[model samples]
Target: MDQIKLTMKELKAFIILWSTQSISTLGSSMTNFALIILSYQRYESALVTAMLSVCTYVPYVIMSIFAGAISDRWNKKYIMLASDSFAAFCTVFVWILLRNDRLEIWHLYALNALNGLMNTIQQPAADVTTSLLIPEKHYQKASGMRSFSNSLVNIVTPMIASTLLALTNIQTVILLDLITFVIAFLALLFFIKIPEIQKEKTTQETVLQSAKNGLKYMKQNRGILDLILFLAAINFTASMYNAALPAMILSKETGGEVALGVINMVTGISMLVGSIMVSLSPTPMSRVKVILNTLLLSMSTENFFLAFGNTLPIWCVGAVLGWIGIPIMNANMDVLFRSYIPLPMQGRIYSARNTLQFFTIPIGYFLGGVLVDRVFEPFMAIQPAQGVFVMFFGTGKGSGAAFLFFVLGVLGVVTCLVFRKDKNIRQLEQ
Candidate 1:
């Protein structure tokens, strides 16, 4: 394969796009941290937090197929602009409710649903646009840039929000998010021009038919489909961890707002470290190898520490090591997926791929909450009933969540081992 090098113009365009998106992400992360704090203050239930996760993620599974199909048929720039605009509007509305002191739990859920829908549309469009603007040789680098931005947001947002909340309010944090969205949308409208992807078939197909075609395309691509299914399972386990982590930390004796901030700071820094490593290094010869190794190592290390480590310092180490693998794994896997899919089909196929990969996320989120609140917490509370779990995870408020994390980590390791045995997955790059 000949490497496609990006020209100066393309590089300039990517820089502008990346800068604007990073600004927006930073603002959004602040608001996300603020909301998590707000929801915990009001509900004080792990189940509620998990439900919020579901509200945020379920829309992708619901709308990504349609959004992907629409993106393929339209100018991706306009799709992104529209999505950003709607998200900004939603933020303003939420701010208004907060100002009036009339904000409710349902309001947050509704806003999350709307935001998720907009993101579902924007995500595929943005990713496909990145692929279009950059040369094939630069996908991993671009992914690294994305990872860095995400890490920056995660690293700073929690600390910022914690301080801001002490001094101001959620309304102020949301207002900042709105401002960032405006900057991003304006940048897209004036500074950047995403070239329209040219498809061989000029005649437009019906929306449903186009979506059906995307599904059909995947059906014929058995290797890709199988890989997607495997990812879906991985996502399910990952979601459980995501849902449980906050509860575990917040409920533990050693954890508080400060501890949470520290954990997030370390996690972000670790991810940034991984992203920088990938960005600075030459692209891997085998993306599949990079992907599997990182996934197995990160998941195993993270869960093991959370399960066995009792103190904040010990857990923080685990958090950092576990997070470091994510960006490396993701950057490589993204390159693999991008290389396999044709550009024109990327919108549809990427959407379809994401829809499947995240299909089990809602279930994981819901179950994480229910199991933690109803099953695990109670089961671990009884001293005599502690059994083998006490030996591994100890007995206390967070013990249940720790046990759950252990199981998920072990499952993630098993998943990587299972995938290694599959011929299609092993040869995906070839």
Candidate 2:
């Protein structure tokens, strides 16, 4: 494929797309945070909290394969519109139920499942469309702007959700989310004008043949294959971190709803900074290096802190300090990924990427829950009135098993090493 450059009009189109997504992303984030908090309050277990997550992600695994093939072959615009509208409609319906105080955990499970399915369609479609609308040279700029927008939204959304959860009902936030999707849908329908790519086809080809072609192409692209593997490792470590952090809070020493929200607020702030840096960087390659460095430091430090569970303030401070690495890594990859893939095949490749990346999340969540409960929590409970588990380093009691923090850091560093050694990855930077 020949490289194309963006026109002035196209840049405006990208802005419109970005604005619309910005609103919808806020709703999505609010709902996600609210539900997790609700589940946490009700269940007090990581597994149940993660079950909501599993419902959200598993559908992506199931839908991505077919969605990818269809993404390559379908009218991409309609795909975006349809998925966005479905998501918006679902938000409204769920809001109505929650507002009536009729919503249940199972309802969250089902609605999140629906959310996941819609995302399977929307994510790939928007990414593919970005490539189609913007030229290759501007992909990095587009990525920067997009990440910046995302960080801006994250910075506010969590803080907003926390305040909303405290001051008003969660139902109010859900209602606001409904309005955001409506605005986003209108922007795509009216403002963005991307020309569709129609691949020339053989008269006798079947859907099966086209699907085979994408898979075969993937098998041959060793560079992409390796990058995906390294990404998966990073994702797995993050998943483990996700499962453990919450358990660390309820570990009997440093516990509170406000503290959990505080950590997220910190994470969002750091991510905003990371996104700004990535957006302003001289090149995408430089941004990737920043991402790797931030992760290494954050993972190493956060674990060290999670190990220091003497008080809520101590754990809270540790939580905020350690969380900065996450958004940087996420923003870096979001830019890098969008820069590389073509519009048509994005769905399949992205879906495949999601499958590999998340395959370990369920395992990690379950393991973290069991380890904390059956292994870590019980042991720590006996060691001190506050400890959750005992280890040679000391005890994770009260704050000791925050030892899992160290474990997460170790896993992340190993994955980073794998990424560093790959020559094909170096080539991508160029």
Candidate 3:
């Protein structure tokens, strides 16, 4: 009876945390969608838009090495609260700048960098808190719920932002973010209590040493290391696709912001479907196979169709097929991580995993933008080459990006196949 009561209490806490955080994510997504529109309109360069992601990711990758260790040492709840407060302040600053007509692209870049840094702090702490709240058996379900909220935010934010932009301005979108932040903040402050983790004090070990220990642990656990490395490769290809998609869609004569929004809505719907399936389904026994198989499915469908198809309907079809596997793969990955890593070491190890897995993303974003703007786009504009490339990727403004997507698709598919052969990666199934 007592165990049942305790389980219900923890589940209730998790639900509250999830709901409030989802509300916050919805607001943040709206602001992000609005900014993407504003930035693309103002700069009219793929590199400029991609640089926003680069700035955010660079700081996140750099800070995560230490952030995880700090989270292990500090109180998780306080770390999350502080990080959220800082992020909210950054959002408010953006709103003030917009209201005063003083906002520049550089300001957004700088603020995003700060926000990314804060995320490094909040993410590991939040991960640890979730582990504390939920039983191990429910990790997959919790992850699915997280993915569902994220996908729903992705779907709703664009439509909302597009409507608000049509009706009002960026300021209104940002103000909405502020309102949501307060709701999330109060909910975490008053409604939820994260259980305390007991840690042995090592007075002699420095923070840097703790971070090093995390790396050492990963090296010793070859399966985890291999998995993270594989994810790094996957993230690289995915980042390039992400950076190119906006340029491709917006550059199309027929497809504008509304078309892009519709495509995003389609993608989000697919992901929501995937999350629902993951939440309800029994946890798979062979998580490694699920991860690899889903990657193959996602890479093949999304990039292939996006590369060849020019029409919005074709893009929507590709989007649906490509995105559906993501939540399924991610939920399994979370279950594997939570089940394998010790709860005490999870904060540090998870951060280390993140650092390794996401290091390639900024590089991918930068290279994707540069290659599209300088190399592929210009090359496709030439005569004989344009004629040849147009046969495969249709001629026009986005043809260059389309060609890049084709190359990335091929690479992603090949990478997944090669990684699937690794015995060490497969050993994680045991």
Candidate 4:
């Protein structure tokens, strides 16, 4: 039988946890934004900024499977607290380094790697805890709430970080993140109680064996595996698009840091609206339809915007239409995961799935940087007014990145259309 329906007690607990986490997330977002801006200003290279993603995701990719096993065997609540505590310490370390004027690119990279490990450890535990707390029926609504929090952070962080940077320094931003972490850790430690999942006897299975079993399960379930592979591929393109976007905004003669912040705020507001829409609506019977259709709409609109939009206002219109699909699609995907996967296996399965799905993100980051810095930049740089490349992507600093966005957008749409025809994916929830 499914877990109990959503109750007042559960809702209240979830709210407390959600609120605390959201605050921490907002703080982290601000720090990350500041770091990106700092990195760009220091190096003036897209590759350096993109390499930050590599350092962050490499550890996450390596630890995901192991972290899942650990979460399943251990107490999730404690694991979450420990992870947050470690992350808070890392933030403090960064703050100290900055204060000492000893912070460097390599230091940031190493810290990002450590932070990724902490996040990897926390992700499965935190995710399954949410699933355990909320009933099956409310899964979509809960996901919407999560998305809402994320969008709210994205909407506010850029402007906040910019203001803080202008007034004080990056260390001040890091200090705020440290404070949020403490608040979140205390809330989880004191008030939230996560229920344990019932596990079958596996007396002989070791942690490594358990991870293998998770992989074996995926191999047997072709539908789930196929879905994971599809997402991984599409995510590669999406990552490239994401990594290149700020460059597109900031590289142009007319575009600047302010323009980038404003664009992000607009995108965040659109995502917030989408999450609200999903929360108000009933869960669809066919989640597959929701996922695929949203993917198609987002990819098409985003690419269109990047390829043709010459001004910030034009980009803003595209961002609104393109970003609106993300929360709806993500909420439905979460509902599917909860409905199909057994609770006991979720920690392991989700971790393994995450590794597979995000394995190519680093590659995407590298590829995005290279495409913009080497091939597209040179190609666009030499173009005349009537040249084909300039005609398609305009002629300027960000035009190369814009061209890359167009290409990725086309690829994303094609990937979604192909995945739509996959019998296994269509019947995955069944």
**Could you arrange the candidates by lDDT from highest to lowest?**
3, 4, 1, 2
In candidate 2, which residue ranges exceed 4 Å CA deviation?
Answer: 1-10, 202-211, 250-255, 284-294, 309-343, 384-401, 427-430
Better of 2 and 4 by TM-score: 4
The C-alpha RMSD of each candidate to the native structure, in angstroms, is 2.7, 4.2, 1.9, 2.6
Residue ranges of candidate 1 with Cα displaced over 4 Å: 1-9, 385-388
Q: Which stretches of candidate 3 lie over 4 Å from their true place?
A: 1-9, 202-204, 384-386
Q: Assess candidate 4 and give its lDDT.
A: 0.86
For model 4, the run of ten residues with the poorest summed lDDT: 1-10
Residue-level lDDT of model 3, residues 248-293, one tens digit each, is 9999886889999999999889999999999989868799999999
Of the candidates shown, which would achieve the greatest lDDT relative to the real structure? 3
TM-score of 4: 0.96
Tens digit of lDDT per residue, candidate 1, span 71-129?
Answer: 88778898888888887887888788888999888887888888898889889998899
**Quick one: best TM-score, which candidate?**
3
lDDT of each: 0.84, 0.68, 0.89, 0.86
Writing each residue's lDDT as its tens digit, candidate 4 over 1-430 gives 2333435555778889999999999998999999999988888778889988888899998889877778888899999888888878878888888889888999888988888888897898988999888878778888999999998998999999999999999988998998888899899999898887776774246878878988988898888888889889878988788778878888887678998998899999999999999988986888888888998888778777877788889888988988898999999888877777788888888999889999999889988988898888788999898988888898878898988888888898888888889999888757
Q: Mark the regions of model 4 whose C-alpha exceeds 4 Å error after superposition.
A: 1-7
Q: What is the TM-score (0 to 1) of candidate 1? A: 0.95
lDDT (C-alpha) at residue 401 in model 3? 93
